[model samples]
Target: MTELLDQVDWQGKLYSNGWRDASGGVLDSTEPATGAVLGQVGQADAADVAAATARAAEAQPSWAEQTGPARAALIRRAAAILSDNRAEFERWLVREGGAVPGKAAFEVELVLGELWEAAALPTQPWGHLLPTSEPGRESIARRVPLGVVGVISPWNFPQILSVRAIAPALALGNAVVLKPDAQTAISGGALVARLFEAAGLPDGLLHVLPGDAEPGAALAADPSVAMIAFTGSTAVGREVGAVAGRTLKRVSLELGGNNALIVLDDADLEVASSAGAWGAFLHQGQVCMTAGRHIVLESIADEYLERLAKRAANLPVGDPHTEQVALGPLINERQLANVDRIVTETVAAGAEIRAGGNYERLFYQPTVLAGVTTTMPAFREEIFGPVAPVVVVRDEAEAVRVANDTEYGLVAAIQTGSVDRGLDLARGLRTGIVHVNDQTLNNDAYAPFGGTGASGNGSRFGSQSSWDEFTQWQWVTSRKEAHGFPF
Candidate 1:
């Protein structure tokens, strides 16, 4: 793992144009579970962002002019390099991002899929023809790259979020300036730089800056950047969107979610319990699609709660790098404190902690909360932790009402014996993504992934959605003879 760091030159240097020292100095990337210093990461400031964006602006045109097959070959090479270093990347994810081994492996798999999907973008048909009303005229509409794209990614699932934007933007002939969260800079930003560098990507086409909010804000407001792809909390996303909106730059925001998993009366308790546990507890419930609210039918609420509590109580929590645990530590102390506060306050507001409401250091026990109401913080807010708040509803109508009550409309799930009933309830719930007879934690590289309302703008990231997110339509017309103007 240390060798991987050395290979990538992860010793206090940013990848702006090329590997160089950042003016803002270096910060230590530490393991959250044990507070061990993994390596030093260069911190980029406003000036670095400007320099990177300017360089990206200069490089984009020629890169765009490259033959589609030529650009695609490089993207495929990057994916190959990522595959070769899969084990090292997984270790880094476990250490820097505090992800469990399984979660780390899953993230890597998703990233590889994203890379492969992006590689196909260059060769896809990007334009269409339309009939013209006038004689000797031809009209066409084509999708063109948005020049330079600025990517701001979060620590949770850092690599996937960053690559989902970066891979597509680069493959679609747009240069990128990426600002990864300081906490998981290596896994998110620097490592990406190394992969592209190893794959023989052109210098100045991609820049990796690992830093605090200053560089991120500068990147968002940079005039040379044509678009901003942001993924984080709703609060931060709003700020980024506002800044980008002022400049009239396109922005893609994949923000927070207070998602739900509905378990109907006919749901198989055993199967639903397993799915619910995985949905809420995977990655210590740090996912945006985490099933924070479990709305159950009143008839089987008791049995469902019992089953959920048992699963929460038995799941192991510890350092993922050294232990065989089901759940890993939260990203840092701030996240852990936030999770604890929500759980404590919700309990005080009359919710019952049915099982496992405790923590030592950053490893929080998977908690099951019963008798939770919509007014409680755990039920209303996006609790990014392994805490499941179960709410009882009289019927499917009440379940849909409770699910749609929140400001977030990111994702939802319905578990029932009848697929038709589950699908019917899914239609009534107001969310961008829904899973019938499944849990809320779902994503695919070949499928559109995003949310509505506070969760995000209407932008999505994946498959054909990537084409829409990274490019804009330009209409072109040609004629054998020029038409006279109606003066």
Candidate 2:
């Protein structure tokens, strides 16, 4: 076992009924920054998924029978356990997920917030009484768990995304079967199992099966699994949604984004540039809400571009574990190549590179591209790298038009001196999330988080949304005596 796994007894193994070896075998977990083998993780296949889901189904009824306060107490213990091991988990995030120190710290904080928020879920109201028309009759509508919830999380922001679903589902009395991305299995899956296990959660209530697509597909298609919460690319989300749809299982899809940051003529270029840089370059732009498009007014385009380009050029990119840098390497060479292809093709299509347009291994520089149009790939597609493409719009209408042209409706931001103008423009933008006089990167554990159109299927996660996502409704009616019916 590696030192990172010392906090928990289980190391690089699947947790179904208990920590055990996987039939599919183990794979090396490598660090993207150095290609070093961090550890070996057990991989789960279709059969493994079957066993886990069966166990979860069998365990869920008893968990749901527990009192609400009892479930809340267990969830609170998990939060405390996470708080105790905060620093250690942050280090694992840096090594396993390629997160910079600051990003790792922020992710840990977000996960903590999620745990805290989820801890309160079980004690909340789960049902309401309904008015009855018949004399001496009573009616009630109650919220109930959806049996086993299968969570399929991506490599980027694995811990935060996975727990946002896992914590709440379990707290709401549903057993969970989590299948984290293979590259981030330990941090996303095993670590979560350990926390809940140490918190005294019963065995079979939670199962962590880290594997590739085969297990994920099986998890979604399994009849025993009533719901699935998936966070990943739009392409994969569609497939998951389709499979879940076939079984008529409830699914929440939080997919990709090509968000925009709009700068108005009356905006402060300094503040706007800082927000834009942070929105586009945070976590090396691997976020689903990354501001890929920068739509600025033509009057202030030159000055805004200068400020953005300067910020981009000065951002340090390297192994975040060894250096204080603004950005880290892309997840792997495949992502790096995709980023390179987008930048190279955009530049070839008449877009001018303002600052950076290159990479060394997986370390891609924070790039700024000017002279970009909506027809170009950089403006139209979601470039999941630290590249900011600026598009000059003649007016506010044109900016809104350009921003809303894409298939994604995830998030958008408007920067302006007047709050009224920013708010008004935000109304015109067609996205699930909008920020006025700010940037596109934002999340709150107590607020509803999701997207529309290609970004998702209009499902949300967090806060009261969790109740709707993880549970179903049931209505019960009763009478004091048997009523006579017409013969």
My TM-score estimates for the predictions, one after another, are 0.98, 0.98
TM-score of 1: 0.98
Evaluated with lDDT, which candidate comes out highest?
1
Off by over 4 Å in 2: 1-4, 7-9
How does candidate 1 score on lDDT?
0.93
Candidate 2: give the clashing pairs: none
Candidate 2 structure lDDT? 0.92
Instruction: Give the least accurate 10-residue stretch of model 1, judged by summed lDDT.
Output: 1-10
Per-candidate Cα lDDT values, in order, are 0.93, 0.92
lDDT of 2 at 394: 97
lDDT of 1 by residue, 1-487 (tens): 3443566555899998778999899979999999999888899999999999999999999999998899899999999988988998898899999999999999999999999999999999999998889778999999899999999999999999999999999999999999999999999978888889989999999999999999999999999999999999999999999999989999999999999999999999999999999999999999999999999999999999999999999999999999999999999888989999999999999999999889999989999999999999999899999999999999999999999999998999989999999988888988899999888988899999999999999789887899999999999999988878979
